[model samples]
Target: MTVLSQEKPLPKAKTGEFWDHVQFGGGFGISAGNDYTDITIAPSAIYNFDDNFALGLGLQYSHLKQRNFYNSNIVGGSVIGLFSPIEEIQFSLEVEEIHVNNTYSDLYNNIKKSFWNTGLYVGGGYRADNVTIGARFNVLFDKNKDIYGSAFMPFVRVFF
Candidate 1:
């Protein structure tokens, strides 16, 4: 008599794609001196669509105080996109709009004013496993309200 044996098939593994659909990141910085003080907090979120690209949004809040002359608040939002062709490099583009409100209180006078700032930034940088360091230029820079003094800005990003 002869006996026949049967083999069972292996089960498929989960890709973890659904759990990794969203990415969160942000940065914070502060600068202060005798005549002026500035603090900023920026938070962002990105939806990973595929392996190489993502679409996202960000919000920025800034508080500025200039000794005894005036105080200002800046609130802004950005539509951001990122592309990575390889494992170690990335290219980013963002469209940002900022609203600035300044209140002046000096001697016996109190005044308030508001303004809008819009810019487009494009840049590329080196990327690590969970961090990116880069420089970007505001192609659509406005001379009236560009606080950075120039069109070039440096950035460091951490991913979670």
Candidate 2:
């Protein structure tokens, strides 16, 4: 008497299959008021390893002005990881490092400051198609040095 085992081998991916799983996403914002103006642009690219996991890189640039009070520019980069346990929900972890440069001018003198800030964000959101809307809290937020005024921030993500 002899016993045999039966198992099927996994199929190999096609050459163009990699491109099908690649996605591009980011955020953009512009706000103008009587004494304040803010503009931001961030672009990112992600590669999906499967239906549930993705990793990506992003670049960000922001310009802010508050009339005669101050003028600042922020430039940074981030690494983000995303996981979807189900079709309607997604979780994310992102790490960002940014350089902040500011110039303050008054009737007496002008002062310049430059520094770097790091942020670690963990969040989850509702996912529909290529968009995700959620709020992320920064674990490493500091009031004196951080760019954002608050540790909690809302985000809208879109990928094409």
Structural similarity to truth (TM-score) of each candidate: 0.80, 0.87
What are the clashing pairs of model 2?
Answer: none
lDDT of 2 by residue, 1-160 (tens): 9999988998877989888889998889999999999999999999999989999999999999998889999999999999999988999999999999999989888899999999999989999999999989999998988878999998888999
Off by over 4 Å in 2: 1-15
lDDT of 2 at 28: 92
Candidate 2 lDDT for residue 119: 97
Identify the candidate with maximal lDDT. 2
Model 2: lDDT equals 0.94
